[model samples]
Target: MVSVRRVLSILFCLLMAGLVSSLAVGYFSADGIQWIDAVRIVLLAASTGWLAWGAAYAFNGLLSLPLKREDKTFELVPTSARTAVLVPVYNEDPVKTFSHVAAMIGSLHALGVAGRFDFAILSDTRDPEVAEKEERWFQRLQLECGAHTDIFYRRREQNTGKKAGNVADFIRTSGALYEYMIVLDADSLMEGATMAEMVRRMDDDPRLGLLQTLPKIVHARSFFGRAMQFSTGYYSPIYTRGLAALQGTAGPFWGHNAIVRTRAFAQSCGLPELSGRPPFGGHILSHDYVEAALLTRNGWTVRVDPDLTGSYEEGPDNVVDFAKRDRRWCQGNLQHGRVMVAPGLKPWSRFVFVQNIMAYVASPLWALFIIASIAAPTLKGVPDYFPEPGLSAVFPRVEQGLALTLLVGVFGLLIGPKLLIVARGAISGVNETFGGTGRALLNTLTEILSTSLLAPIMLMYQCRAVLEVFFGMDGGWPATDREAGSVSLSEAWSASWWISATGLVTLGLAFQFAPEYVGWLLLVAGPQVFAPILIHVSSRSALGTAEAGLFETADDRNPSPVVLRQEAILAHWRGAEASAPAFRPVPEPAFEAADAER
Candidate 1:
């Protein structure tokens, strides 16, 4: 006989599948409401659902505002508290990763926290070339910056569990020496003060298993990069804070830029390799959220301190790059379903999984909905009115203002976050906080325009990921080249044609059936169909040429990010005239651990 869990899982899967199939059949059957009208209803409902969710998310963010810390102060901790900083690296840029470590080490030593904190470079790089680079960089980091701290390097002989496995291995063997472990991504940077503060917070709040920070985007040079940076800075906080509010003890773990209690994590976060095949079965893709859920389920608080600063990460610089990164996320998030039905899972865990599923699935649903709305009028149907019984059994009716409803909901949800960010920035009088209202508004417009175009492309990409996850495709942690700044048109064309095809199909379908709406929607999707060309020209070099009046540029129109000016100036000054201020390098320190008395 099958287990109870398996039986329930089978029943739930069958139920969901049946519901979806019934909807699909009803929408497509010629004998039902005219095919066109049926399609329209499905599309309209799905699109509306997406926009509604987005609105809910916006409000959720707003509601969480009161709970967020407004005054930022670093909580100082005794460095001798047996703390270890864990930097997990997959195939990542060693130079860039080490540069961050060097910077942090200097900052910590400056604050007298170096002696208290030890550094661990836990690498899971599988590629031989990347692994070699990581090794060389670790040694260089030790020579250049690790002397003052106890620096340890360990590469998994087999990168069996990806990041979670790597962390698990460390916890099992070497974790007992440290009271807390600070986790950072390969591209992540956090100040020593923040690290010390996190340690302090963890110590003070014994029930707190994790303390996460809002990571600001840094080193954005490309047009897409700047756009993404703007969005991350402006909009991420609200959503994050909202989630934090709801999850006073169930906050998300974004895998990095956080500190975890060693004992709590070791006891709670041993992720079971999901049973079954590839993609969904073998290894968890987005392990951070799952780990956080596991910890939370065990009565540990997972807090997000959005007020904490000095955390940073980079964005994928272009459209293609963004989608490439998203493909993996799509797979990972979709795979959350495995745990969604697992026994002993928390309600918050289910909520996170559902939210993740919608992130990817909603795109395809919207695409379908958009197509259906346009085709509705063209369908040959029976009499407009048909009903039965006292309950008035009937299909969902098509609203005459369907298009307006769709646009309002989408714009409100997508545009509201930015507007709120702008309002917050203006109210606070922090011009640089969100790159100013002028830039924020412009960024919002650019985002709306760009996302609209790219939506179709992303829809196709997401659909592919969905199918792949269903069919078992692996999106293991790929070695990302942080400095791999540019992509050729050939690369763009080769990678992005599916999106182009999706756009083209949308255009074709819309034009054929919904000519009235097709013109407007096509106008939106045309650039997205050829996003590679548009995105490339929007970069810095293109901005320079356009600035030179090559394309009839009249006044000085600068799209360069104002927030980057300070950092850019520093870089320029360091490169041009003098050497950057050099700090005393950290000398290798020793550690002694006592065995527990028998």
Candidate 2:
């Protein structure tokens, strides 16, 4: 059934692509098809197909039933497997990251399962000053959680291989100490029960190499952050369900908030540096996807349980931060060219590799299409109406009709799935989680508008990143400013001046070569011309407020116990007044007695 669904999904996208390409054929060949016109048509169809592929996923997910989850009342059996909760950090603030650690530790103890799980703060932080701070915070973490041997901190003198290397180092030295490991990022926080449930699932299936949970974004305060939070909480589940349907035994490991079999990962995921230099070579920067592929290649069952909640992570608060993060991801995906067709990988795994690469490559293709359209008139000289002196003078026809049709089709493909989800939410009363159906619809519209405005700016950024990689500029691992504040106009302009210039140049070419396209070009290039203003405004945390009720995710109103626990711990440590205990036991009422041990 899964295979059938996957095949149908592929066919649907191809059909959409072929249909749009045929329309493009008519549109471009109206004056008779030229070589450049063919290029323009192909680009338009490919980019449109990418959008269609995304819509297909959403539609498939909307129809597919969610993965079966155990009943909430199901008793958790005690497992003898020793599991290490590994939190890998790199040049991050000890205060915030350790607070999450303290919260998870307290939650584990409150569940009375601390004995089954131990934690290691795998520090790949290179700065000496940061290392000293990490040690001091580790001491405080022990005291705060009242833990000694259960919580350990290891800092490597040389931060080799970045994060993947950090975990591989742990597997080499201490993989023998545990049966499983829950790898987490610096910002990841999971509830005690979720961790236990993961362990229970792993124990039940010896072949389960990795079990990934869908981690929600928490503690977002800015407008962009809140809007993104709403999208993830609302839309991600539906989309991930579709992914879960497609990814049967060969699944994704997002590198965090996942439980992995220690021996399986240690044996299968020992990544070697690729043969070439930076960018296309060296250690894999996007190690998570590669690790998943490797695990699947080794015959270990890898899967994601989208219904498994209570897992959380922080996101970039503003646009610049998001773009910066995207650059790293683009570089990593580009690196996948080396491993896309390795000897023993599954077909779906290779498709995932292609999917990720096209995500970035699509931007440049769109740009190329636009450029070609603008230059089409001049590139093809006056059509030879009477070739060889006897042909009929077939007059050229206006091309706007099919072009407009293709445009509407592309827009529909992009926004239609989201609207369907909105409609379903309203019908099902699920929009109440997004502050009721009215607000949900309004917010969804607002998100659509914002994304439309931001699309061109992101396109330029991604195009530049891809071009840099092509020309051998490696996107090194950069420290993320996760909680970025506002950006000044000057800063915005400084980062995006080339974008403004590119937009201006495109408009000028449209006017000179394709006068009829000036209006259309304005729509695409106008946003880029004003990108600095958009970036500056979106970065302002003040734009997004809880009182607005525009982006009210369920987490905003009813935060999970783990989220509240982390916030409470953070507040206490940061000297803010706190009104709650270190760990608040929810349904596990029996463990409330263990709260005071902190």
Please list the C-alpha lDDT of all candidates, in the order they appear. Answer: 0.66, 0.83
Best by lDDT: 2
Residue 249, candidate 2: Cα error in Å is 1.0
Could you report the Cα RMSD, in angstroms, for every candidate shown? 9.7, 4.1
What TM value does model 1 have? 0.79
Q: Which stretches of candidate 1 lie over 4 Å from their true place?
A: 1-39, 63-71, 75-80, 374-402, 473-484, 538-598
Q: Write the per-residue lDDT of candidate 1 for residues 1-598, one digit (tens) a residue.
A: 1133224433543443344434444434423456566555555455545555554545566654454335465767454577878888888866667667766776677566788888888989889998897886677678765677888888888988888888888898899998988888877777667778887777788899999998877666565565566566667777675555556567889998899989889888998878887677778978998888888888898889877766777677776667677888888898888878867777767877888888888766766666565666465544334455556546544333544544554466567666776666566553344445675566567676766665656666677777777777654332333334666665666666666776787788787776666655865568658866764544433344323322210011322121222233234333532443542332222100100110
* Global local distance difference test of model 1: 0.66
Q: lDDT by residue for model 2 over 1-598, one digit each (tens)?
A: 8799889989988899898999889888877888998898789878888988899889987886533322342246878899999999999988799989877876777677878888999999888898898897677778666553388889998889999999999999999999999999999999887899999999999999999999999887677777788889888888888888888898898889999999999989999999989888898999999999999999999999877887899998777888888998999998888889888999989999999899999999999999899889998878767755676676778788887997788899988998888887776666877788888888889888888888899999899889988999755333433335667777777777778889999999888888878888887799999988888887777444667776778777666666777776776666621343343322333234334322
